[model samples]
Target: MRKYFHIDLNDRSIETQTLSGEALARAGRHFIAKTLLENDVATVDPLSPDNPLIFSAGPFAGSNFSNGNRLSVGCKSPLTGGIKEANTGGTFGFALGQLELSGLTLYGASDEWVVIRITKEHEITFESAEPYMGLGNFEASRLLHEKYGDKISLALCGPVGEYLGLTSGIAFTDPEQRPVRLAARGGVGAVMGAKKVKAIVVDRHKMPPFTDRKKLMGSIKQYGKLLREQPVIENFGKLGTAMVGDYTNTIGGMPVRNFSSGQIQDPKDGPLQVGGQFIAELNAGRGGETTHACMPGCMIKCSNVYVDEQGEEICSPLEYETIGLMGTNCGLTHPDQIARVNHIANDLGVDSIEVGAMIGVLMEAGVGDFGDEGFIKDVLTEMHKGSEKGRLYAQGTERVGKHFGVKRIPVIKKQALSAYDPRVIEVTGVTMMLTAQGADHTAGNMHSIVCDDKTTEEVTELSMGAQKNSAAADSLGLCVFGRSVTEANSELIVEAINAAYGCELDPSFVLETGLETLKMEHEFNLQAGFVTEDDQLPDFFYNEALAPSHKTARHSAQAVNEVRSAHF
Candidate 1:
């Protein structure tokens, strides 16, 4: 059994709930949504003490259950004004599982900034965060390690988060002890900051107990074997997620210059400099890692360590979203330029997607020229300092666009859209437009869906199914990158869960968890005053056609909502 803690930061009180069997399994996004909905978190001010910040680990957490240690951090999003479940792969979840803890919720705000430490001895201490305050994640992480030693995983609120920046995301320590892995969207960091939690330091220990260790071990080996045999997984392991840019660029679905045009470079002109194939080759030649695991036991290792010409580390896991939004969207052609900014963004613990979109909008407003790396650096520096201009930039893309009176802001539900442009990537666009999580591509990323001739109903149907699947993956702490294997082998997946927890669950439980998660999240958003009209792409997407394909979003909010309403 694992213990879930209700931490009252107000009075330093703690309430523990023991979870076993399916209760331990039914965690992550599903748990967050259900708890929030039940607590009437919808009406609470996102930054208020009433808004609980939840962290959940999956059933197989701390085990060698490839990609099963991803942590879900949730709250009413200060950025989107709706429910948010921002999950990330890191050692945080693994640490929680090691300590035999399923999850914890920070209830109410602390009077001062503090570091909460959880030890293997079952001790919870609230330490002063004074020294770590006003520091970036890198420095804070170092100091935390210095104070608490290296045998701990961290969840840090960066300098931006300390000031309650909407662009901020809670940074988690990776297996390598780098606090770069982030639950990086929808202002979860801002909520953590508002709670005055500078960091959560959990001591790492050996893997926790399981009901059927032999069966679970067999399942683990089987899952790894299945992963090794999959072609898609192999490709990801080789080139990482940047390979997605190659396909998106080829199809004219890649976001370029603040969503002005889709295609970045002609395929006839050799490989696109910004595309995955090019980056993989470039990094490989520079003696940098093209494939690395962000979390322990993740054999599908799609993450990377990007390097400069001198083979110096620039950034770890330079991803497609960061490249598309921060590189192509901002009109910066070189990966080096993107990498420098990525490091700074990661250091500041902000969502590179939101910050990139915000910067792109600023460029669109003529505040700075496109491709001007110096100007981008200046803006980020200000953000780190929490200057007036920096704080304004941190409000995120939507508000920043309004502040500058820019007409073509790329946002849905006040959250910046992911790299996928709705005009060309229709199914992903539908998912982004409708998801309660607010334009998070992970909610249901069907980048391969063909919508060229499909009706709005047909498109929504496809989107709905993908959403359920994605939600299930998130709920289980399984990476969507493993879906090619996991989705096809649902019986095996259920068998593994049953083996670990000694509970009986069918394959259908996967989709059921997803469907239930969506329903709960949607209900929360609805009661939070979000109307059907809130689920839509910006006006520019509907009116302006993306180049090459010259396509515009055709899915109407009304039609999509009609189908969703019927199902939900």
Candidate 2:
């Protein structure tokens, strides 16, 4: 029998249940399906669902592998009126896995403020936390560390979430209790705040070994070997994802100044200067300190703890998304400034991508001139103060556009696009339009598909394939980084599953689950009153002519409309 605990946040209660083999299998599939379904249903509701957040760590989470540490957060995105699931690399996945918990479902509103602490041996406890109000993630982490000592892993939110900002996100503490890792997107932090729960403290003291330990270890060893042998995996570990920043900028794929241009002036002959510069500076100061693993048994320590000029820690894994959105897109030339912006976003609990895009739009509207570091700092300072202008900015791009009457806003389904410029990489635009989760790049980043194609038909087909593959990756709790080398090798994943569960499952089932999840989310959105018209970019993108590369939007309404028909 498999044990599971269902906690009700409203009354601070818990229900324990055990399931047979058949029941466990069914529940696993249902839980995965329902996560996609519930968010879809909530998308069309006028007031939105109260505290509907689903956090699921996969069956392979605790295993020793390069990519085993991934967790999924599903909720109705305030940024996009569709289901959104943002996955992150952090210790929370491994901790949850050790506790043998399949997932956590948070629902309903709470009357009194509290924080829930769960452990392998101790019963769930809802403790009053009135003293910790209006604290940022760092301070919150300090308080939790004081109480729980150094062993506990925490999932926390900050004042931004408390204010119910649309771009709020949940922050996960590193092993050292620094609030650096984040399941940070789609306003999930707000959902936690709505439940009147400030944080989730997971203590896995003396947790028992997972069932089928021998098989699990064997599969983990096999996959770990494969990951080690893979060239891309090796490269990613060494350089991380920002290695692509120079490449994207060179190809005119990097969105700059709110997609006003794709290419920026390269100080070097190649576009490698920006990425190389950041890597050099980071390494020079705190490069070799410790490339820490987000989860306990992870081998791919792609995450890093970056320190600033004073040798004080600033952020972790200063990633491509943050650099792209905050650095290039916002017209900031310096990486340190970008890092500071990233730190501010983390402290505020808002999505950095959305905030970057929001600030870009503000620059476009003369709220602050592009590349004005002083003005940018002032705006962020105001936001921290919760000023009226700050509140408007905190609402994200679509809401800000609506409030300010800016017709040139770049968004699809009410959410701003990420760092990639769709005009240069056309297939990703298709994914952004058709995905049930609005304009999320990860929903189906078709960049690789476009790279592999020689013709338009080939591009379309490969993009569709990549989209399906991404969905499958999400369903299986495997990082897309792992998928880059594996491609659609379902058998390899199935082998891992068989090793973990002592049962045979065709890897193709993962693809089916992905499709099923997508369909369920789509149906829920339709029921929630989201129409075909809602799946579109703003008209300004069509008419505006972006400079530098001098590229204008070429996708017609017919072409954009074809995305829904092709995918759905």
Candidate 3:
């Protein structure tokens, strides 16, 4: 049986060690659920003040499975007044797994700023974070590398987080000590800032491997072979996530001009429709670099290092969401500009999606003309300088709308919607609104729903299923990409788990676990003061008809109400 040590940062204290077994399973569920509820209640209570954030990993985290490296960072989102779990890839999972720590629950605000370091040699130390304030991720990373060396992985927040910017993100160092990976959603960085934690560095030196090595390795080999044989996985390994840009544009699902249209004629979509345009453009001139992996021993290298005109490395892996939000939505077709923006966001420790959405909203409000790269760059410069306008942009879309006195803002629950338009891809929009995390595409990302007809009922059904599936994937510490193969026979995932853990379990139990987690989060939000009104999209989406496609938001208030009713 696996043992877990629950660390409560509420009083900078530790709880008694807990063991995970059949006897404690129900107790574990209740304990976690109660912890979550207490945090939610405290967030609203006048007497007891606390801001809680939970970091959790499943038992399968350190296993050899291809997608088992996921880590979840959950908190009440600064952007959205509900539960938010920003999942990401990093060595933290393997490190935590090696430490046999299932979850780290942090609560209460610190009087003085601090940084926590967990070394692989079973050493935990807390240090002052005063000197690290106002440092960008690149500079902070350099400082940590100089002190901790390349073997240790660090998760750090930058000046944006220090300033309590709602869109700020946490940056985690890769194995190379580059601040490349991110827990870059739902403004968890702001929550960390509020807690006065500048960084969490994990050092897993000389830690032994997982317990069930033989069974884990066998399952990993089987899944790795299955992934290698799949054509989609192979293409992902080759082209990386940016390969979806062209397909999204071609299918009229790409968000263009603040999602007013989906049809965009941007060269960023791999040039004009010449045959093999994607391949040809990739081959021409140092643009399309070789795909690479984010972590050690990752077989599907679905990431790339993008370069600019001067052969300078611009960014690591220009993705579809960045392209859609920064490229087409902002009316800028230059991949170099997009890459630069991504780099800027990374350095500033802000969410690229929110920044791009803010820029798009600004353009829509006529503050800057669409496609005006110079103005866009100027706004970004202001953000870098921490000016008033920069602060406004950093606060995000709904706040921007309030500041500018504009009601036509594209947001849900004060969070900006992502790159997919609701009209063309209705299911994702529904999920964006209904998810505990507001306006986050990744909260559900109902791409599978695009296969079905976009009727109101079908859209609702697909959104619900996608939400459940996403919850399951996240809880299992598996990448959603693996869902392409595993989603159909989800039972196979349970079988793999059973084989690795030497436990007999039915697959339905996995789904049940996910559903329970989702329900817990939702209940927490309800107690935190979220309402049915929060579960609806911004008013503009329904009233305004997006151009080119000529499709208005089809779901009515009643329809949206019905969807939320079903879920609740």
TM-score result, candidate 1: 0.99
TM-score of each: 0.99, 0.91, 0.90
- By TM-score, the candidates rank as 1, 2, 3
The better-scoring model by lDDT among 1 and 2 is: 1
lDDT tens readout by residue for model 3, 1-568:
4444445455667553554532222222223444667654425531122556666665565555776666777666778766677877767765666566565666677677788887755466778987777777888878877877776767787777776788887887654566867777778888788877888877654433443567767777877877788897887877677666666676667777888777676445455331123422543467555576665556777767777656568777577787788777888776766777778777887787887888888988889988777777787777767788887788887888777776667788777788888877788888887777778877578653563455777787777777777777787777777767657656667666666555567878666665676677778778778877777777777777766556667775467658656765
- Candidate 1 residue lDDT tens string, 308-329: 9999999997989999998999
Q: In candidate 2, which residue ranges exceed 4 Å CA deviation? A: 19-40, 43-51, 206-208, 267-273, 276-282, 285-292, 448-457, 555-568
Local accuracy by lDDT, each model: 0.92, 0.67, 0.69
Q: Give the count of colliding residue pairs in each prediction.
A: 0, 0, 1
Quality of model 1 by C-alpha lDDT = 0.92
lDDT of 3: 0.69
Q: Best candidate, TM-score-wise? A: 1
Q: Lowest summed lDDT over 10 consecutive residues: which window, candidate 1?
A: 448-457
Per-residue lDDT tens digits for candidate 2, residues 185-221, read 6677777777777888887543335557676677677
